[model samples]
Target: MTKTHEGYFFEDYRVGQVVRHAVPRTVGAGERALYHALYPARHALYSSDSFAQACGLSAAPLDDLIAFHTVFGKTVPDISLNARANLGYAEGRWLAPVWPGDTLTASSEVIGLKQNSNAQTGVVWVRTTGRNQRDEAVLSYVRWVMVRKRNPEAAAPEPVVPELSDAVDPRDLVVPAGLDFGSYDFDLAGEPHRLGDYAVGETIDHVDGVTVEEAEHMMATRLWQNTAKVHFDATQREDGRRLIYGGHVISMARALSFNGLANAQMIVGLNGGAHASPCFAGDTIRAWSEVLDRAETGAPGVGAIRLRLVATKERGGGLRGADGKYLPHVLLDLDYWALMPI
Candidate 1:
């Protein structure tokens, strides 16, 4: 019988140690369709095979976050199995666009570690890289997590924390080569908003909702290779409900913003994001976006827009708000940056 790898202890990791995660996935039209249905993504290149071919891609590729999830999911056994909290991510970049039928694999190198003062926990940092079948780098990021030590009395390991970039510079943003929205169909893309129309500090209420389902989430998690037990196995959860992946909600909200924020492009900064409330199979997910800031990137024909995406559930036959905050129906609060046509 093949033994299942539960996870590793804090004592097991060492600087320079490399951990390769298993299971590569091939994205397909179903995932693409689900992405559009879940969020409202209208990027012409990703929405239509014909349009993608015009942009030089053989077919519509998977969304960027899909690639991130596929890569990040691989590290769960090596990184977050016993984690108390995900500290942060830095220097994250998407190098190459991933297409359907492309296989994605990932590995992470232990970069640094710090034994916490409490002794029961320590912080571990790793630089994770995702590569496609051809061995080209797809995405990379540095992330740290607070991991609980099995034994508080264990001897402390050498403390090391590598310095990471605060944000990927705007000039460093890579636009998909040959991408041209000049002949893009605004109506078919689901929005008429253009890069020149949006003003700074504008808030757009994306008027769409999707009630997530257990089967849908399981399919998504498995598709990403995110084998987090709680997200799939009902027996592992106390309430007998499958916990949805946080990133799923994030992508859903980001896609929903497409209605009025279609030009919002590459996600440059993930300042702060949260799954504010637990979402279940029957809870309908609705999203709204607030334009937080805007700036010009050095990249030709591209600009950066910062946005806050809020998702909520329907209650009492209508969406409800509690005081100044989103009601318990609120599912997510995400702050991030995106590159857009200018």
Candidate 2:
């Protein structure tokens, strides 16, 4: 009898399978402290209790990416333990604020599956939901990964690709209750830009960069409890180097955006995101954002803005080339809607 556990492979998933991930985490101030220490995150709503209260929150909530990384960590053992790459994300939404002392768990349902033509790997799409202890869903998103097959000769499963939206509908964005930014303090927020100050088709070069370090990247991944081997095990890849988690790049880019978008406080919806290239320890990440659209919400002093946030190793390289593929320097391309003071 054997009592060891390996992980799922390409041939092991079905279109309707559901996986309830284990090891629920209780997040609080400690997570917030470590996150700030790891990255140059200075978002006001996530930094000070008083600042959050002034904006109508009970207190400062954890950084939205902290919630995302914590929840994403729990799903690693089940969904991506043997993944070759985490491809993309879609239809993500932050439904509620995750406060200190909140316990979070995650579950995922396999919504789409397609075996690659090479037969050695396949794409598995899952809709994952992270819920707080009270059974209230705090976050939800669809992510797909490429998984290696345990048996290369296994027959391919029937392909069932999901129909995903190109972008989140602004009307579907959820604004936190009592999040009134009408009396927002421009000085405190560090940027004078407001909801009305930004126009559609405008672009902002954040004009900053941070070089990722091996120690910091590893520490950040471990802080989130992400146990994927490629991020930590140098032997897993051909070059004998650790791969930085894609989420790390995303958070780094978001933190850099604070220079020009300090008031884009809460990320309410994640329409789409693609990790265009692999980031190593020494890559210096820079960010830029283009205002896609804006809308008024029913909540007083709250509005939504859709923006495309791009992370690149070098500046001034267009996101896409003439061939319609991502440029070599582009590391990440994310589209989302965030709440700002009107």
Candidate 3:
């Protein structure tokens, strides 16, 4: 039977529980084109069949975050169905690059649980994993959420919180084997920036906008198999408009940041993020980025760049204000990492 409700409560979870989320996905060329048009991403390995072939791949692989969202979205039904808040995410690592036409699926296992002293709420932690049709592990991460207890009179469960790392170690970052950018085309990659050019604290304002549409959001959410009613059923929303998937804004902003941060590769961490405001159809989204931090990894020929990307809807003709507060036109506040050429 299909379980309805997201934002699961504290009383509903137990340690050792495994929730297998439904709906698998098959990636294709359309998604590849969208990745290019959406972000200005021209990584030779992802953009050219010839370049990819030289490196021994059939074609460019899907962006890493695409694999992440596909995996994360599956756990929503069982894990977040009744959540009060998404506490945090840690230990996110991309294990393998996913090629187009590959089918993927995901599942989550509850690792810990804690009941609040108030007896009305508690916390649930889960480790989620994604795999391809071949059953190769593609991505994994840990997340926790605040959930309400159905019965306030019930005794609180013993608290158990798993220790997590502050940041994923650079040594742990996995590079796709046989990835030889030696034959990379600077022109076709869409920019002249290379691994050596970006500074640790530089920011870029990706100057483009895309007017969102209901059909577009629906198609995207359904494509990820994300069935949140608010994102799809207009009637379920108070404003009588479908809520754009937060991931859509994330993708748009990440893609736009490529203009100046083209060499930033492979998101290795998802420290935190927020959908500051609801994005609706017809809202034109634009993006800007701030370099939060940078670290030299032990990996040869690679560095890690952390960025904060903000997506906003243009108010008439110009970008919105900068009080660090999202205007009604704002859509997302994202913080993450990317691997860059050294």
Candidate 4:
């Protein structure tokens, strides 16, 4: 009998199956410190306890993406350990604020599956929910990954692609309890741009760049407890370099957007995202954003702005080439909804 525990392959997944991932994590100030160290995140609401209190929160919540990365990392072993790629994301929403003393656990339900034309790999879709110590869902999203089939000759299962929402309806966006930007301080927040200041289709170049470092990327990945081979093992790919975790790019880019979007405080929804190209250490990542749409929220003085954030290696590289495939320099393309003061 084998004493090893190999992760699930594509064929192992069945629609409607639920999996509670192991290793619940208790997050505290330490994780918060490293997060600030890893990215240039400086959103005022997340930076100051007083600011958060004034905005009706008890204190500053953990960086939204920290909650996101920590929860997403928990699903790696069960979901993407055997993955060829982290394909994309959709219909994600932050259900609550994660406090410092909170413990987070992750679980996933297999909602859809499809064996690809090439028997060697198949796509697995899962709706994942992250819960805090109190058993309240903190975050939820759907992600699909391409996982390799142990045996190429395995019989294909009938595809069960779940019908997902094109975007999270604004009415469904959850504002943290007591959150009120009605008295928000524009000076403290660093940027005076509010929801009305941004026009739909308006593009803003974030005007900053950070060259990713090997030590830093690994430290961030380990801090999140992600053990994906492609992220840590250079031998996993034909190239002799470890692939930078896609979430790293997401956080780095989100942090960079702060210069122009400082008031875009809390991330409440993730409409779609893609790791269009593989990112490796030593790449200098730059970001840009386009305001896609805007809507009024029920929260007092709050509004929702849907944004398309793009991260690239080359300064002027576009997301898609004429052929409709992602340009080589395009690293990530993310569409999300954020809370801004009206």
Candidate 5:
């Protein structure tokens, strides 16, 4: 028997299958330090214990993306090891705050599959949930990836594309327990623009940029323990360049948004997102956001803001071209909801 693990292919997946991913991670202050070093993340709720306590959290919780990336990393070996691309995401929600010393485990349920016309690859959809040591779900999301077929001639499974929501309803957004923004410090939080200050249809260019570096991107991927082949194996692509991980772009864009949206803290819901274009090292990434809507949350003095965050290679580029296809300069299109002061 060969001791090597070759990983799963598109044909290996079936609807209704459940996969418990390996390598649970215990995240602590170290992950937070590294995350701040890797990205320009400076949200006060995540950056300061005193600030978070004032806002009613037990303490400064790990950055939401820290929880996200750690959990998503655990699924890569089983979900996207042989993937050609990670397509998109939808209906994601952060269920609970991930405190320091929390151990996270992940599992995925295969829900949808569709073979490609070329028969060389197929798309597989999975709903993944991340839980803490107490078995409380910390995060949940649906993602699809295009995986290569080990045997192109294999018989195709019946296509079962899931009917996913276009966006997460604001009422369903989870507010961390004890989360009160009544005492939120606008000065320490870095911006005074409260939820009421933002109008629907308004756009804000973050007005900053970061040049993606090969080493930093790889380090971030390794930190998350994401073992996707295309992100690490140069030979995986004919172009001979390691593709920057999509989550890396997401963190960078979210960090950059701080300049203008500093108080839009605690991401609670991810409505939808796309890796609109492949990003590589040396690309200068810029971010912009549009306020899509606002809603009152039941949390004390807290409100929810819906945002369309766009990341682009160029400083200010249009999202779609005339044909409604993503422009080449666009790198990511993320729709999400965050908690802010009323």
Candidate 6:
């Protein structure tokens, strides 16, 4: 028997199947250093231990996306190795802070699947949870991907589409234990705007753009341990262009939003997100955010703000066109809830 292990294809998944991903990672200050180097991330809660302590966390935890990318990388071989595209995300929540020296592992359950009419591709939906060494869940989310089939003639499985919510419920959000914003420092946080300063229906333009560098994208993907061929091998696509990983775009946009949303410290919920268009090297990424909603939380001196964060290659393009599809310039549209000082 051959020792080489090939990745799974469309027909390899079934509803209710559980996959325990391999290679748990221990995250620490090094990941934070690399993250700041990779993106212009300067959120004070993640930058200083004292600021986090003043906010009631024992220490500054890792950036939320660090935990996301690490866990996501673990599921790639099992869920998206042969994928044509990672379609969308929904119902994501950070259950607890991933402190320094915490080891994380991931597992996924196949919840839904449907074959495409083209017969060469199918969509697989899975709910993945990332846990610490103590087996306490730190993050959870649902994502669907389009995977290619090994044989076009193979029979299709019964379609089972999961009923997902449009957004995460505000009442269901989990605030990290001991997290209190009562003593938050606006001067140190870099923004004076509190949760009350932002109004529903208000939009803020984050007036900065970063052009994508081929080397940086590759390094970022490799840092996540993602080995998807399309991200590194040009021969995988007919256009001879490498598709920048969507997570890269998300991080870039989130970092850019720091100018206007510096106090939106912790991302507690990811209601939904879509990769509106594929990004390639040399694209200049710009971002904007619109306040969607607000809610009160039991956490002392903390409130929740729902936001629609949009990333685009160019400025001034409306999110949708007359046909009700995303404009060509749009790269990513994400909806999430964050904690801010009240």
**Per-candidate local distance difference test:** 0.73, 0.94, 0.73, 0.94, 0.95, 0.95
What's the lDDT for candidate 6? 0.95
Instruction: Output the lDDT of residue 188, model 3.
Output: 61
Tell me the spans in candidate 1 whose CA falls farther than 4 Å from its real position.
34-41, 53-58, 84-87, 115-120, 158-162, 234-241, 265-278, 295-300, 312-331
**Considering lDDT, which of the candidate structures 1 and 4 is the better prediction for this target?**
4
Better of 3 and 5 by lDDT: 5
Expressed as tens digits, the lDDT of each residue in 163-201 for candidate 6 is 999999999999989989998899999989999999999
Report residue 51 deviation for candidate 5 (angstroms): 0.4
Q: lDDT tens string, model 5, 152-243?
A: 99999999999999999999999999999988789889888999999999999999999999999999999999999889899989999999
Question: What TM-score, over all chains together, does every model reach?
Answer: 0.81, 0.99, 0.81, 0.99, 0.99, 0.99
Give RMSD (Å) of candidate 4 vs. truth: 0.8
What's the true lDDT of residue 92 in model 5?
Answer: 97
Error of 5 at 307 (Å): 0.6
Q: Which ten residues in a row have the lowest lDDT in candidate 6?
A: 3-12
**Which segments of candidate 3 are over 4 A away from where they belong?**
1-9, 33-44, 54-58, 83-88, 112-123, 146-156, 235-241, 294-300, 314-330
lDDT of 4 by residue, 45-120 (tens): 8889999999999999998999999999999999999999999999999999999989999999999999999899
Candidate 5 local accuracy as lDDT? 0.95
Per-residue alpha-carbon lDDT of candidate 2 for residues 231-323, written as tens digits (9 for 90 to 100)? 999999999999999999999999999999999998999999999999999899999999999999888889999999999998785899999
What is the TM-score of candidate 4? Answer: 0.99
Candidate 1, residues 1-342, lDDT tens digits: the string is: 859776776777898999988777666667677766655567665677886665445767687887888788888877877665566666777778888778889999999999989888899999999999999988888878778788788888988889876556656656566655555555665667656677766767878877888877777777666766668777866789877877777777777777777766456555555555777788787788777767676545556776777887763222235455445777777666776666
